[model samples]
Target: MLDARAHPSCISVAVSRAVGEAYAARNAAAQINCSETCFVLAFVPGDLDGRRVAAALEEALEGVPVFGCSSAGQITPHGYETDALLLLAFPKAHFRCSSILFEPLKPLSTTAIATAAQRHEKTFSHTAGWHRLGLIFADGLSKQEDVLISTLETVLDDLPLFGGSAGDALRFEDTYVLHQGRCYGNAATLLLLETDLPFRGFGFDHFLPGGTPIVITGADPDERKVFEINGAPAAQEYARLVGCAVADLSPQIFAENPLLIEYKDRHYVRAISDAGEDDALSFLAAIDDGLIMTLGQGQEIIRTLQSGLDIHDEQGRRPDFILGFDCVLRKLEIEQKQLGRAVSEVLCSAHVVGFNTYGEQHCGVHMNQTLVGVAFFGPDQRTLY
Candidate 1:
């Protein structure tokens, strides 16, 4: 049963018990041809010990390679999950993996990120320009993703980067990074592959913004913090637009009505994660001065998420694995209608097995709401069409 596919050799899924690790393991096993078992996890919240967790994982994998991090939330074929641990094991022969950690993002510089990315790429690029994709996981709170993305792009142009931030179950404190049976803080990791493979990172949302544009009048690029927009604090202007009290604003509500910013003509929505002091808004992505941003449009209870599956069938491509970067707000929207179970069913039907991210990265840019995801089709399995 040696699947002669030059796709992802294997995928390692690691989540917390709060995320229902047992269920996650079942789904992951069914996704790709995983080896024996998964690198299991039990997110013990405040008492987390990376050393203990890593040690257990290394022993369990029995020398098979494993890589992942603690998540703010996890996803399965069943959609968004919380409070559990999940880890999937895929072998190295099929997937050449390299793990790296990059921190000290405060005085962020593209030069530094470029250097880091080059070094990280070299880890698995043992054979240059042969990698199929780059899986990146960085500090969610780093607040300098723009520099990181730019640096990676410069080094790995068109080398598609897909992944999400290491989240801490909405606690927003003490996020962790996992590598070689050890969890570190304020770090980043890259699991690389040196396979020439065909892949596409696709996305579709109910995105149809109101088309009203507002300018970012004041801000600090270095901090990635937006203070004022159109003559008032960014948060205040947003509150007025959404007709909600500034005090009532939060990441949950802001995600419901994300603001869309125009970049290079096309539009991209920026998910506001935190509302800081004096009406400042902490955006998940970059927002430049004089940029025109419109209110993003999408229903809380979107119904067409499964429409993509048809493409999978019609295009003659069967997925080897699905890496989903779902916004936490989208999960809330699903929960509001008690559609959690239904959403989960659709994702399960899609054979998805990954984690819920505070935010997602696609082609290196950070975004929310939209499912900026990539599906791998083994060179052999994808011939179904």
Candidate 2:
């Protein structure tokens, strides 16, 4: 049970297990006080009908703009959940937003996207005392995230952006983003938000680069598919590097032993999503030939996760709530290590409300096996609506 009174500074959060029906959305919507709500963000279970959920929310919310996508799983006030429909209502008293939807993400035109984003930013009325940030939700199966995020960052310039690729419960099929009352596939949405509360955007993963470097000998960057690694079949090479047989390759194995690529001064994981035909490998993020990467070594996941979420303001006050975009791979890793309950405890204490994703977007990069989020802190001595 989520008690809104427990966190006065936070926005309304409602969760419902009665899915695939209108009454369930109505029951959930009834829990949120929508008088001041500007928009409602929803995280629907991948097993449900997106169109049905979208229609229900639209009818129940009575015209409050709704936006979101199907997720691999949700993190509610109660922590990790798989079958619930989660909603977060952002009140107009504290937040304002404008959203843009891009369909047919394939054959994406960076030029067009950049132009539209720049124009959208300029046209949106900037609130006098509010800080600005961006959130994006794209079809997880869409291989366009790398290009999409990079273009947005380049055009938006200083505005911080964080998001996740929508997932279908690890089914790796048919994912959709919902806007208004419609569900769209091969699509994405960007929400430019202005908020009065102080906030911080961050991302982290629990892995370190260690071991001999493996070079990408052949790859299809556009498709994010690797054909060869170190002159051997991609999956075969990865299995050898991780000390596993080709037949033993699995999501858990990929999560446990990810490939790390060096960028600037830090390393980022380039997770393999699946082993494909002819020992080929499909990745979650962008990949190309001649890219040198190393096997990632595990760390104390719980410790790193706690440290990552334990953010404090100048006054040493914890955030009221965190909007998290955790990768599904991370969840897989935690479950594999039998740390689900422990990890859920950490998230519940941190007041995390969001969903697990196929990939995460932070700053200007698309990454895998990481958690990206924004933490919001209320103004001192002021009550949030």
Candidate 3:
């Protein structure tokens, strides 16, 4: 195992007020000192040209393989930000990296996601099975994550995948994908790293069912639409229970009281991504009958943060970094509670530096209310290697 003390991987982040030539130079200097062979770079610029920003980032890195997307919000040792940059560096021998790119993706399709993962595995095989875990990200615009996640599970086997979508600052308008210095839209990116690195991984999220759980009586996942809950139109029924007009159901409201789905003792919250006409509610995940659901809220971010920190301490590893995957909903919840200081406390305690995401993935499975992370214990200090 990699040592957690000596020769530990170093991580440094430089978020600029700008992403022009000025910010790129400073960010490059920080990365140059930290990364051995390569680093995972993310740019969350507030106002910048897509092509120009990508080009500047590429030039600043001096040809290092660059991959990451725009973030809705970012987390660092300092705090969260809407306009800034966050970069993480891993030593060359400390990690073997492999990446897969898929483009022009549409709504969820398990078969399509499976195929993408298979192709990614072929590329990952060259890592010589040293992949300790995966960091997965995608176009925030892609809504088929549930299908994509389940498909990757079949191919990745036991490897845990973690990361989030490239957030567009909640603009929800135009989001870009970055790979090999090129930017695109409607794409998926996966990073597989092989190493005997010592690290701990886990995440947390909470859903309080406000109403009685109802089974999914009908769904049209491909269309991103749900027609029924317990044999009744999902939107109409849910609205009646909440005493709100079905037409008034908004993404903001959907996030507060998402439809909860129960499966095998675990309950998953499916937030409304969109509300279709005529009492149809589109969800972030697939909805089928027989699954009990209740309206949920982000009331437990404080608890989730505490539990996440507890789990991190139990990992038996000294963390160099904690890569996080938090949903945008969590971001909103933070603002609601005015818990920025408290949230930063968790990162400071764990020594975390990561970005907020659209939707998070783990073990090749999509998830929410979870802070999927890998806490590094430098190989130079451990006997695992």
- Give the least accurate 10-residue stretch of model 2, judged by summed lDDT: 1-10
How well is each residue in 96-185 modelled by candidate 2, as lDDT tens digits?
Answer: 999999888998999989988899999989988778899999999889999999999999987999999999888998788987768899
By descending TM-score, how would the candidates be arranged?
A: 2, 3, 1
- Please give each candidate's TM-score: 0.81, 0.97, 0.83
Residue 157 CA displacement from its true place in model 1, Å: 1.1
Q: lDDT: which is higher, 1 or 3?
A: 3
lDDT, candidate 2, at 237: 86
- By lDDT, the candidates rank as 2, 3, 1
Candidate 3 segments exceeding 4 Å error? 1-9, 19-31, 43-46, 107-131, 230-233, 243-252, 276-278, 288-291, 297-299, 312-318, 380-385
**Deviation in Å, model 2, residue 384 alpha carbon:** 20
User: What are the root-mean-square deviations of the candidates from the true structure over C-alphas?
Assistant: 5.3, 2.3, 4.6
Q: lDDT tens digits, residues 1-385, model 1?
A: 2122312344544433433333333333343333643332222222344455556555545544546666766674335667545555544444455656666655666677777777666554355433467777667777666667667766888477777766676667766667666666666666665443345566555566785677889988656678898989888898998889999996668767888866566666677777887789877677778777888777535466777543463457667666666666677667766888887877766656676666667655676666666676665333221
Q: Which stretches of candidate 1 lie over 4 Å from their true place?
A: 1-51, 119-131, 195-198, 313-315, 381-385
- What does candidate 3's lDDT look like per residue over 1-385, in tens digits? 2122212245445555555744654554454553455555665554555566667667776676767777777775565666666655555666677777777667446566667677766765554434367677777667767666667766777777677776676667777777777777888777777775566666667666565656777777566577887788878887877678877876556656666655556666666666677777766555554556776644567776776666323436556666676677776767766877777666666666677776777655565545666666555444221
